[model samples]
Target: MNAPAPLEIIAMAFSLTTLRVDGSPTPALCVDDRYWALADIAPEVLQPEPSRGLMNVFGHWEHSEPLLVAAAERLASAPPLPAPHSLEDVLTPLQYPRKLVLTGANYYDHMRGDAGHSDWDKESKAPLFFLKPPTTTLVGPGRTVRYPEQTAKLDYEIELALVIGRKARHLTLADAMDHVAGYTVAVDLSARDWQRDPRHLVKFDLFGGKVFDDSCPLGPGIVPARYVDHDDLRLRFWLNGELKQDAHTRDMIWSIPEQLVAITEHLTLEPGDIVSTGTPAGVGLATGQWMCPGDLMEAEITGLGRLTVEITK
Candidate 1:
């Protein structure tokens, strides 16, 4: 097979009320507002390189220096991004995509030495999965993740999310990568207490804790697939500025190619369909640190981009 062509890094921006540097809330831009669009300034400022994950953008201290400092200065001085429309007003023009399929426990190390192994066995035999409603999407930054009354043990999982470029069904591993349009940072917020209910069993509990409103916080930017080296990108997560989860994409037991093949066997993956590859271990629950109201969660992938959210009561 030939090497895939290099992808141009696409710029995506999120409007938020608060800046990561400061905790004060600012106005969030509406999803439909075109003012949210920002220039892909990373290239002109920094030397271009094809690296997968958020680091592809944030890794360049020199290039990102301007934006980061500008944001910081704004936080210290200027007002926040304008929230021009009401929530309902903004959601109206926003095109909500359909169908988001997530792969569970796709990392090899995560399935090692526990009930997770048995779960992996079942999944490998018949890949464990779940669906997230599009309405759950929080497209921009500075948005507060509300602590659902249904769950007290909210957790964060940072995973590389792929956006399908075209319709695909029954595709072979060899042709799988061709269907991906771009990549972004996805935080799969899991409610451990609700998800681990023995009464429902693991399979049914998969969606219980994970499918809440604003559970999936994506974007800030979307890097086209051509720019990412999917086989070996690094992913990391932090809570309140402390490192928690860290792993390489190459560690996935089931590669993207294999995952695409497995998923398409029964269902068609259409354009705008999203696939969140599994996250590595070290989540809040796994570490005995559950997310509470007022906690900050930040996630980053090497080539994709950084995504941060605040948990609210």
Candidate 2:
């Protein structure tokens, strides 16, 4: 198996999807900045089915990229092509990850408002994180986030999500990138009021506050690690069509490599594990503007595309 030449690859459906583009999943590729249906161009390569899932296309260590590049080259020389289907036309390439690990206050700006932290302006010696139930929280774009009724303050955090391709344990910072499968966008939707509530009997209210159903919205397809320019990628979050949070990945206090090294130091991360690299400032809590039912939230990063989610009760 060989890696596909540097190209931004995407996944489309050939079977049924929530939003049917061609009355079924539209198996296609976004390559060389164009769209080509896999069936039309690479029927011999593979077929799309929910059971087979996108793992064959995305999780493959060596074949995923090469297969995409071949298909893209074929489409480039082909005759008039059909218009590419919108990302909304397909389901998330990989649906749910086995583990959803979230970083906390990894961003300098985000630390200012972090709960009960006196060293908000100073850098920490190590990374901090919390785990969310993957099956309940992991969802794709176009999905409605069920606003939990227990809290009135709902918030959103836009973070660059790392997808682990192979098993990683006791990894060093120098070798961390080798374990990354790809990059995708993720929203760390939170119930701030619940997360910070001091009155709760449980000492670690952060768990209860952040682990509600539909709390983690991940997707809009994954961009293979080979194609991402991580040096200074732009990250933005919009609320109700208004730009709210904007920052660069370079500003992170703990670089992605360091974060990975810190996490894998004790815990073994398996393939398909997703670690969202914390959000920047300008969360709703900062302005006392909480999310309400019917609010539209969009989280976007430079290489990985945008993930849009609607808020509902």
Q: Best by lDDT, which number?
A: 2
Mark the regions of model 1 whose C-alpha exceeds 4 Å error after superposition. Answer: 1-94, 113-124, 137-139, 201-204
Q: How well does model 1 score by local distance difference test?
A: 0.62
Compute each candidate's TM-score over C-alphas.
Answer: 0.69, 0.82
Q: Show the lowest summed lDDT stretch of 10 residues, model 1.
A: 16-25
Query: Which 10 residues in a row give candidate 2 its minimum summed lDDT?
Result: 10-19
Off by over 4 Å in 2: 1-28, 32-50, 77-88, 113-118, 121-124, 201-203
Clashing pairs in 2: 4-65, 4-66, 13-25, 15-25
Clashes of each: 14, 4
Evaluate all candidate structures by whole-model CA lDDT and list the values in order.
0.62, 0.71
